[model samples]
Each structure stands twice: as C-alpha cells, then as structure tokens.
Target: MSPSFCVCRVRVSTGHCTRCARCASSASRCTRLPDPELERGVRAAHVLRRLGSDFVVFAEPHLKASNMKNLLQKDEKKEEPEQTVPCDHKTASRCLLNLMPVVSETVSGTLLNGTFLPDICLEVVHDRELSKLPFAKSNLTVVLFADISGDAIFCIWKADDKSTLADTIQTVVDCSLNIQKNYGEWPTCIGVTLRVKIGIATGMLEYHFFNDDFDNVHYSASGTVVEYVRNAEMLCTAGDIILTTEAWNFLEQKGVHTRYTYTALPEDMVKVLCFDPSVTEEEKVSFTSAFAGVRPALYALNFEDAPLLKRFISPVVVNIKTQEELIFLSEMRHVTIVFICMPEFIDIDLATLSQLYRIISAALKETDGVLNKVITFDKGCSFLAVFGLPGYKGKNETCNALMCCNKLVHEISAMNM
Candidate 1:
C-alpha cells in the first residue's frame, strides 16, 4: 500500500497525543517525527485548544482544512456593518481646523475697520476747532486720533514748530477728553489699554456730500481709501500724526502747510489730490415724493377692503406723476368704474403681467364676494379693484380689502420665478 497519511489528535490541556499513525509515547518526542506529520499534529493541537475538552478530532486531512475555513467565515459574520460619513460634515471639520490659527488675526483686522469711522469724525472735529485759533489756519492741520493706556486721545498740532505743535496737541487732547466726559461718551473702554495713531491731511473743503439727479453722492472711497488709511496709520507712532505726499500738497493749498519729516509711500498708493464739491437738493425732494406715492399703492394691493385703507387712502393720492395711468374695474352691479390718475406705468413683460393678474384673482376667490375683477393700467401700474359692494369683502369689507391686497402682492412675487 502507498504510505498512508493520517492526522494525529493532541489534547491541549494534557499535552498528550492520542493513538494514531503519528503518535509518540512522550509529548516532547512528538517533534522528532517527520515534517508532514509534525505540521498535522500542531494544527490538530490548535483546533483542539479552540474547541475545548469535548471536541472530536478527525484523522482526515480534507475534513480538518474544511473545518478551519468554516471557523474563519463564522467569525467574520458577527461584525457590525461599516457606516458612511457625509461629505458636508467632513468639509466643515476640515475648514474649522484650517482656520483655528488665523481666527485671532481676522478679528484684529475687523476691529481696525470699525475704527476708521470714529477716527475720521475725530479728525474733522479737531481741524474745525483748531482753525478758529489765531494764525493756526495757515499751518498744516496735524490731527491724531488714538487711544493711550486706555484713555481716548485726540491731538492736533502744527508741524512748522515742534514746540508749538507739542503744546497745541496737549491742549487739544485735554479739551477733547473734557468734551467726552461731559457728554458721557468716552472713546475708550474702561480697563483696556488703547493707543491712537494720527494722519495729517490739509486741503480746501474739496469733498462734500450732494444730492443731484435724485441720487445721493458722497465721497466715493473705494478699496483704495481703506488701504491709504491703513498705510498712514502703520507709519505713525503712538502720538505721531503722519501724512502722505498728496495730503501735504492739498494742505499747503488750503493755507495749512507742513514740512515733511518722513516722505515715502509704496508705489501702488495713488494720490487723491482733489475731489468735486457739489450737490442738488431739489432732486432729493422729488425722489422722496416718488417713493412715498409708490409705497401706498403697493400697500393697497396687499390688503383689499381693509379698515386701514379707509384711513390710509384719504391722505394718499395714487397719481404722483404729471400724466397718470388709468385702471378699469368691473363691479358686481354690472357697472364699470375707472380708477383715474394712477402712478406711472410699470415696465414689465406681458407674460409676467398675466401671471400677476392670475395670482391676484386666485387670492380674491378665497374671500368669496369680497373682491371681484381687478384692472391695472399699463404694464406695471397700480391696480384697481371693486371690493365688498358686489363680491368678497361685503361682510368683512373693513379688513378684507387690505388683506386681499397684501396676499395678492405676496403671491404674485412668489410666482415670478
């Protein structure tokens, strides 16, 4: 017969092999056997240890291999399923981690932006006050707006004489503090250390706010304005008021002149030497009137037959323009009424106008006979509706009118997309 290969069984607790073709009398002698038999013996021992005292050991090699494979498959079946994390949550986590170090730096920059408004106000106030002094108008207006050791500082000086500038700046600073104390509006917070830097700019009142052509025009300080202020501030020491070359030139022309102590600027800084000073007050009044007329017209459309409109319409005149738009509404009594002298026609496409009308009609239908036909003149003109007399608002006429108008505008705008 060919050499028969037989598996041996070993008891892990007793460290003894049961009778088989590979068994040895002594446990230590088991290692002396042939390599093939020794491997089979070791594998058997492992299996016996895992199965405990009552496990059956087989002499067949094929059965042992199949059993080990089944054991591993069973172990894998007991594990929980893996979960997926959302992309947005993961992205937010990454962003917060990256921004952690820079958060303080960003906050410091934002604080600087808020300080710009207050600083400008201080400089203007100081300049006006100093100009009143004898012979001070001819020298440069060096204004410093800063905080020193938690005290708000406003300093004004003239650069022509260092001793005079120091004396004037000290005097002005004292007066500014007294003004704040009297008004209960100190510039600095208590218990916090603060420092101020000043910028000196001199010129005629070349820049001013104006209302022309129904639009308000003020100094158009784009991104460049903030940058210039920041550069000037950076060059200044705690009490020093620094000025750019452009500002010095304008100050010289305005009768307040300064000798440059430090004169250098980055190549990118553009000099804003002059600006126009003009405004039209008439256009502002007209614009206000136009807005007032349109506000009520829009409000009336929102609340039809509302008690408020009765009180509201008496004081309001819909026709704000020289030429009025007209609206025709069909009444329940079979009489057609016209709303004359409406506001100017609104410019809208036919499709949008049709949709707006549909929304208004649907909203009115909800209130029964309180509202009926609505007629609007021109594409975007105010609407005319007969409320309560023939339809929806008859019983609740006081409130229904306003309610209908409000709902109509809201629903119409919602469907615009």
Candidate 2:
C-alpha cells in the first residue's frame, strides 16, 4: 500500500555505509530493484499455499526497510510566510537564505553579497542521518543546504555571541545524541547507524552566497577558512565535535575547560589542534550536576515565546537555597566567596534589588580571567557572590573574583548616580 522500497541492511558511521550488496549501492545508502519476479513469485506462492502446496517462502529477501521520512515540517509559523530556499529560473536565485539569519552587515548599512559573515561555523556530515534535518530548522542552526547532489550538509552560526555559541553547540550535540537515541525507534535504523562528523571553527567568517548567477558556487567552500572547516570535518571520527585551534582557544579563554592536546593538522588545514568536545561522563558530572535537567518547566502562558528559552544554562549564577544545597557545596573549600550585603540601614526595594543583583552576576560572567561558573545568591538585603568552585582553578581566580567585585561596586555606584 505504501511506497515499496528495500531498506538496505547496512551499518553506517559518518558517511561510510557498509554495502548490503555492491550492485545495491554506489553512493546511496541502499538501492531497491523492481522485483516483479519476486512479487509474482510471492503472489503465486500465496495461491499455492491456499491450495495446500508445501512450497515455502524465504522472507529474508523481500523484507527490506524504508528510509527516514521527511521531518522538517514548517512548524506552525504561518504568520511568517513559510520561508524556503529559493528555486528560481527568472530574477530569483537558488541560494539557501535565512540559514544564518544574523549574517553580519557592513558599516555601509548594506547586506554583503550572500549574507553577513558570522563568528562561528559548524559543518555536520552525516549518512542515514536524514532525521536530523528537522533540527536544522530549529532556528538555532542556519540550515545552509543538504542534497544528494552534495556529499554532506552545511550549518553555520553567529559564534561571537557567547550565549549563542554555547546554545548552538548544545543544540548540535543534542542533534547527534537524538539521532543515536531515536535510531532503533524507526524500522530503517536497524539497517543503519546515524553517524555524524561535526567540525566547529571560529573566526571572522562570512558564509558566502550561492545563487543562480554563480553556477559554480555549489562545488565546495572555496574560502580558506571554509576549506579548513571542511578539512577538519573530514578528520572527525563518527560523532566527533572537533574544533579548530582558533575556535578552541576562544572557548577555552571563556573558561570552557576540556582536557585536550595539540595535534598539528595538515598544511592544507587551518587549526593547530583538533579539540574534541566529547569528554568523559565523570568530567562532565561535576559542573553539570549543578544544573543538569534542573530547569523548571516553561509554558507559553508564562513565557513570551520559545526563542526566549534559548538563554544558555548560565541562569543567574547562585547556589541552591536549601540546607542540603549548602552542605553539598560546604566541602568546596578555599573558594573565594564574596558577600556583597547592602548597608543594613539602607533599605533596598525588591525591584531595584533584582536589577542590581543581575548586573553584578553578569559582571562576574563577562570578566576576563574569571572561570566559567560563578555561583551567586540573593540572601535578602545583601547578595552572596562565590567563585573558584570546583572545575575552576585559574591561578588568578581570586584576583579575577576581586576584579568582578570591583566591577560590581563601580556598576552599583553608577546605578545610584
């Protein structure tokens, strides 16, 4: 009744797919043949069996699986005309617009040729991973393009925004994990594994344009940075998130700690080291325990829109408020805990207090030499600020904490002025 196609019984990792049969696959995951003979044989066998014929049927050859279905349903965003990649023969172009929605603009107030160049670019190379196409439409990733005409997929991001960068990375990682998690849920997954090669690079990059005029734009990324990202992607193993040195350095400087070493990539490449984001579970548990799945359920009635929830896990940095929470962090010693209590005599209103507290918390996050996590608390008339918790041992941790403290003081003073 449905479209009949043989789901190739082949294992897949990255772009490499094991052949169910040489003739069955050239570059595709699996090819189905018009088995009129098999179909006729089966029908005839059914008739024979009804007539009590002993003729047996080998079910193996006929029971092939189907490919993943299209999941990129234009979510209920009808108010905004269902935007799509242009497919034109006249004045229009074939470029995939809106992938990196926030393409950089020049000082001249004109959009550059294709789109504004963003700070970070991530390429996802996948085979039998067609399901992830839906996530590409999730707004976090600018779905550049994906086609059987091309070898893999291209997704870009505006990496300079620290929160955007973190969210983008988290989304991409979630995509990879979901692909694997939901693998066996579909019939086709038994025949293939969704393998992904992720290459993340950061720099002043303008993901160029591909239009009807530039017929040659589809060959591959021509720019040096783009080429380097592609090369890094190729070097990635299955499900690896490899970052170029520049990108890795930028994140590391921001206090994202991961145990990595330098590996001189090929001359044709761009990064000094290939840093992998897939750290051990033990390594992640320490900091992640602080907020893993700890967020409260958000609803449309309570929040503005879904995009608002995109704020990265850096919620107002404050420790949990219970005795258990305090005990949990009690053993965390030598930590620079600075308590900024407003002078007891000066009564601060709740509204003003909230604003000042957030400003101070943000200062800690933005301060250089400060580590990633800065736990803060709103203990009534005064606020408690703590730094140098586990996972952050920067030699200048205390000094940086003091810097944040001074920044907080200056900002609060300016606020009053």
Provide the clashing-pair count of each candidate structure: 32, 7
Assess the local accuracy of residue 341 in candidate 1 as a C-alpha lDDT between 0 and 100.
Answer: 17
State the lDDT of candidate 1 residue by residue for 44-90, as single tens digits.
22222221111122111111110011111222322332221111222
Best by TM-score: 2
| Candidate 2 per-residue lDDT over residues 83-126, each given as its tens digit | 12211111111111111122112101111110111111111111
Q: Tell me each candidate's TM-score.
A: 0.18, 0.26
Candidate 1's C-alpha lDDT? 0.27
* Candidate 2, poorest ten consecutive residues by summed lDDT: 113-122
Q: Pick the candidate with the highest lDDT.
A: 2
